[model samples]
Target: MIPVGAYARVSEDKALRANAADWREIGEQVAEQFKDMDALAAELGVTITRRYNDNNRPAGDPHIVRNDFEALLVDLENGTVRGILFYHSDRLVRQEYDAARINRLFQLNPTYVGRAVAGGTDLSTQEGRSMLTIQATMGGMEVYSTRRRVARKNKGLAERGHIHGGPRPFGWAEDRRTLHDTEAEELRKAVLAIPGGLTVGEIRKQWIDLGYEPTRNKKKPGTQTLQHSTVETRLINPRICGYRTYLPQAERRDAKRPWMPDFVVRKDGKPVMGNWEAIVSPEEWQACVATIEERKRARVEGRAAHTTSAKYLLSGIARCGKCSFPLMSNQYSKGTASHERYGYRYACLTTLGGCGGVTRVGPPMEHMVEEAFLLEVRRSLGTVAGQVEINETKHDVRLARIDQEIAEVSERRRAKRISMSTALDLIEELEGERDELNRQRRQLVAAKVRRQNISPSLPEEWKGYSVSQRKIRLRESIRAVMVHPAGRGRRFDPSLIEVVWIEGGK
Candidate 1:
């Protein structure tokens, strides 16, 4: 019912960033500030209706927008709020420009007033506004002065190859020059296993099973264990390869975070190197990064790439009619000269839940699907052959562009104008581009290969291709095979199955 606007703010410190418990300490301070303002509002016989807070955010950052403060000003302009309340005037506006804007608002609206509970400064007349301006200017000066001092200290610490008073990075000692032997070994093992065909999740399981501890969290006063996220961060950080990165702090925005871009530039336009010992070689680090990136792309594009490495006829392409879940293939074999080869049976993974109860023998089903696919391919090979050639030509052009981009980045690195970390980041980006281009090239070539094998001129050539090659051809020509439960009395019935064919793209 009362129309009073209240504001509060606090800046974050290094201790608050490093120690999770320190957040509670900072929260209590803001709470106490609100307590004093609430008392003042009650003394004046008005309830505080709208509250604004910018806790742990910089007040003097030029690019930082104080959303709540701006909203409070909007409310004051429209005469929605009769008065503004704060523990002190400094908390309301630290920057001189912000303080002047508040003065203009008060001048335009003579009836609009502000009250500072703890400070005795009144906000009703000319002398009060002058004092408020002086206090805000002093607060602004303190903020900028502190910013310069902190920047100088951090730059010095970085130049010396020591962490700038935060939690020590994983796999490194407190001094950050020497590797922590046990943790460093785990880091090496994890990074090495990535390129050796182990998924990040698998590596996490192995480390957790071995009771591997992460970097010590001295702020928590307890042992910390390795986590998947922390593992990923350690793998990509150039610091692991004895390189220091300097990311300038910037205002938060919706587009990208400050640290998202490579910011390892030096003041004199020269490369910056680190004095610390390297935990992993640059080649090992790059390989690990590439593996992680490829895995991420696989997850985004299709679940087919994420399936078990077992070469099944339709591991990802087969589905159950009832639950629509993929039918996983299980391998079985009997020891004998004629039966030693692995046999597969496709069954709905969720069959135990009674949703998809279908089970089909792999060999017979695969044979039936292949026969149908060959028939369709024979009828449409002429149309698909033309499109395949067009796609191949397009891929060749894109591959050339990717090669040019790689050369450009290499040239930039040779100029010696950017820091080593920046050059490495650019190189990684170019490598990813190159890898994607090469994958497209492979797809184009494989399309051409399959077109030749499945040509109308040589229809039986498809049968001679490897199982993996046949699987790829199957995916290109068919979308899914939905398997239904066999009819009541029979063990398996082919009439109940539905094959979904993929149309050729022109």
Candidate 2:
């Protein structure tokens, strides 16, 4: 018997299924196809020396490289196999380049046989080569036609706010229109709590402890785990606020890209309302988006969410008066009595680019700063009563104008009117301006919310605030806590702690 190779492939879209039973069915179909190819080889009196299977791989997509197919070509070129067998011609070649490669291989080895279970093609004959070429061309046309149909169907579904086929979205039931009660409630609380100082990391821990699994994990059991990026992506998705967003398959695969406003499906410059029930109001959702975006920007700039040795109120907020370095929270062991006594202090260590000249007892200095912060807050509450609204309006107008400019720049690039480098630079500059405006607007909105929630018992309320909350308030009200070095042997002095108030006390 002459030795030959068998090649088989199943595209990802055709093989993927939501349930185990459906996956088993796809597996059976693949196995049957291989079995038929084996029968064809037996009839042709050929022995199958190697079997190449490219499972869950697309033949037409240029981005998807079929490794097994490439390996089979190498074996054919090396004369390891005298011929190749497949289930069908279309399954073996769906793109013109792929067909060209196979033709070149056959031209170099004129005697090599190419056979399919459905039909046989002798590569040495001109008629057989023409038949294979026609089959490949027809297969490529079919792929294009199928893709166009799927795209049209998906667009129609998105416009109608219907869920197209995929893994079920979080906070929504399998039916897609109804809410998953527990997940929906958790999402709603997260949306509201984020703007009120809840961090994404905190929410991730909360969900993990509650035995919550990511939605995509259902498709492949025990494969995926919850991640911080997943949590942030879910939070920023407009679907929670009853808005449809249609992301192309390519963009969906580019998961590292930041969420942009362009993802939302729009009709006449407004988001298309989804058919599903909204878990949160649009305003609440927008607030969450702004807060998340600000946090992301802060992280990129290395300005917020410092992981310090301790969660001291002024760890990253206060600076050394001499070297202008941020003070870090530190603890030192004192003389031991029955046990060692620990003293907490904020210090400027030379190792951390500080002058090493400033040190202050944590409690006393923190107390003084707290008192001054409250006084500043109280003083500013009366003066900034209506200023936040006015500033927010101005920012909104500026943001809209920036967005328009960005859109125009993108259009010019698409039309080939601008060089790629110039378009990129323009877009980057506009995006930076837009992000800064967004940060300022979110700060104003947060301040407005804080002011509305502030009660007459300001000092009492200050006592109940968490360290993180206090840090946020301090950064808002005071530009920096300048800790100056005190004279040797001088008692703990509040006079050395100078609180520089922010512009207009906030």
Return the TM-score for candidate 2, rounded to 2 decimals.
Answer: 0.79
* Candidate 2, residue 112: how far the Cα is off, in Å: 2.6
* Residue 10, model 1, lDDT: 72
lDDT of 1 by residue, 83-129 (tens): 78888887787888888888777778776658888777566666777
- Model 1, CA-based lDDT: 0.67
How does each model score on TM-score? 0.46, 0.79
CA error at residue 42 for candidate 1, angstroms: 16
List runs of model 2 lying over 4 Å from the truth: 12-28, 77-80, 119-121, 124-138, 218-225, 258-262, 302-310, 333-343, 371-386, 390-466
Looking at model 2, the pairs that clash are: none
- Candidate 2 C-alpha lDDT tens digits along 1-506: 88899888777524454444455234555677789988988888889999888766778887788998999999999999988988887778888788888888888888787887876766657677777888888888998888888878888888877866767788989988799979999999888767656677778878888877777747675566688878887888788889887866655668656574446665544458988889987667767787777666776798875331126778777899888999988876556431243257888999978889998778788888888878766766546553535244557767677778888999999999999999999999987887677657655655555455455575677775556556666776689999998887787888788888777655
Instruction: Give me the overall lDDT of model 2.
Output: 0.76
Each candidate: what lDDT?
Answer: 0.67, 0.76
Separately for all candidates shown, the number of backbone clashes (residues 3 or more apart, or on different chains) is: 0, 0
